[model samples]
Target: MLKRLFKLGLIINPYSGIGGALALKGSDGADIRQQALIRGAEKLSGKRMAIALQALLPLKNELSIYTASGEMGEDILSSMGFNHVVVYQHQAQQTESADTKAAALELIAQAVDLILFAGGDGTARNICEVVENHCPVVGVPAGCKIHSGVYAITPKAAGQVVAQVIKGELVSLMSGEVKDIDETEFRAGRVIAKHYGEMLVPEELRYIQAVKMGGKESDELVLSDIAAHVIELMDDEPDTLFVMGSGSTVDSIMQELGLSNTLLGVDLVRGQQLLANDLTAASLLEHCANKPVKIVLTLIGGQGHILGRGNQQLSPELVKMVSKQNILVVATKSKLQSLQGRPLVSDSGDTTLDEMLVGPIPVITGFHDLVLYSVGSM
Candidate 1:
């Protein structure tokens, strides 16, 4: 007897994370994508999709893939030697939101069991516009701003979820929120997220990412204490270069140090003074060459992600150069409690670095306060 084939649909937003490494905040508008290209930013949606598709390789004979042509899907499937049919075709050089919507509709028409897409929140919103709750979808995190709950914690994790479904495992379906922020406000260091709608996603608590929590930490005293402790560390290690990451928690620390900060971008500080503002991955490497460096980061509210959410500027190369020991995580105790016992995730896009980042790490919760938390790559 022959085994039934698992029909899977794939969509890759070729320009999804184009603006991340360049510090443009998002790849929303065509103008922003163009600017990112001009600044030498490479589109990583395909690469991220490839990561998610790796786990499906062993089951290729029992799988059938339906996707769009060229960079959106066909190219990747071809390169990976997967059997795929192009249900939709578009100009590979310039794909747009309309293409994504059309592809979603085509996939639905084909009655695919699942639609796996790679991009950030904007891509999720695009799919939500057409598919709604009509089809089950899985998101591969490959965007600059991933505030939606539909995506997996990482690309590889997305593949694992799909693999479970292929093997006829009991995968529960849940409505995942599709959220997106205004790029204009985001570039200005203000986050204005709005709920677009929901989609049916495979429920895997350990794999799926939670919706990003909006607003600042309301506990001013806790933030003050955390800020004071970071300031003390800065004073003790005056010669050490501190790479300040994004988030309200880290911004509060910068406020306490009386230094201007790029709230949504990485900043470099030394001797209690801001060395550079909004440095890209390459620029960060250039500036921190052969210097004693420590990276200070904060968790992404409900998500519990210390890396690979929005701070793509901290490339895997930079993370490796600085080493895990030099990383400092700051979060309020209340913030940590909001996770409901989920381990912090490190989806740095490098599987090896993410694995190396695993294990117990200390988080600064208050002034002279530290809590041990386990970090994992899901």
Candidate 2:
């Protein structure tokens, strides 16, 4: 249980991940002319609420929650039976980033201990764009391409960890992944993941940890070999959306493909053409709208996160369109060994997307070989 009298702020972007799932061509989509709910948005939002409810339920007697108005904040609390938990005083509608910024600023003004939010990497970037490390921040994943390290493994897990932090449980705070992607290219089957910055953990959250790095260092020769195999696969394929994620490993693939790629950036490749490079969220989605796409990414060695690290451009909204089957993980055997006993930490800032990526998945590093990658919770 959490210690008493912790004032927390809550905010949500009720429509954050809805656009891409609608095939509407962007992550900014909040309305559909078709008059039905977008499944992607609902699922992500539902997961956030569930994890939050479960995590906060045990601490109701001792804590107070201050939240934004309407779908973004109150509904989650209402569903969890939090009538007395003072909702934030709203000055306007709950639809834009301004709303989030306003509410966040208000929360800070009120001296809230921390703010728990649910959104994507863009959302995290928005918060970080305006606010600093004045107060602790946590994320409940409910967006598409999350690359921000503000989120926990699950919404409930986020809540549980926050509770632990409040109780001063000797946890360690690690620098989180601050990444965001271009959603426009994401649609046209292109991806441009960029590192925005890092976030701070409250030091009591055990379920959430920093992305780990290898201690032994890299063997340039092996990376070269793995990169060659991935490029060969790319060359043999028919005209397809080749979404190349970031990192040195992927850069090797681009070199073999004869395409000039951003060394530490996401790039879009389709057959002989280089579609887009170094794009933002809006850019990736615009490209992926109606294309046949294949995602090629290398796993983060020790953290095990294939998409969340240097590739935040693969948002939940984007992932929904790509589906789990479309994702291809490329890593060498040596790399897999490094990740063998760790959880693929996804501080993508969106809890729901991380969950979607959790579990044993195939790691394709060399030709005709795939290893299963498993996620562990500490």
Highest-lDDT candidate: 1
TM-score per model over all chains: 0.54, 0.49
lDDT of 1 at 29: 88
Poorest 10 consecutive residues of model 1 by lDDT?
Answer: 204-213
- Candidate 2 residue-wise lDDT, 1-378, digit = tens: 222365677778666666556665445533441222534334356457557767677777656778777776787688787743444555645367777787787776655556788888778877776556555678888776666778877777788777765443323444566788777667678878888777555434222111225433245655565666566666788577878888877777777667889867778987756888876656777888788877877767676666667778776677767755577777655566565455445556666666555433445544433433443321
Give lDDT per model, in order.
0.85, 0.64
Local accuracy of candidate 1 as per-residue lDDT tens digits, 206-304 = 212221245344477778888888889889999999999999999999998899999999999988999999999999999998999999999998889
List pairs with backbone clashes in candidate 1.
Answer: none
Candidate number with greatest TM-score: 1
Candidate 1, after superposition: displacement of residue 197 in Å?
Answer: 0.3
Summed backbone clashes in each candidate are 0, 36
Angstrom error of the Cα, residue 373, model 2: value is 34
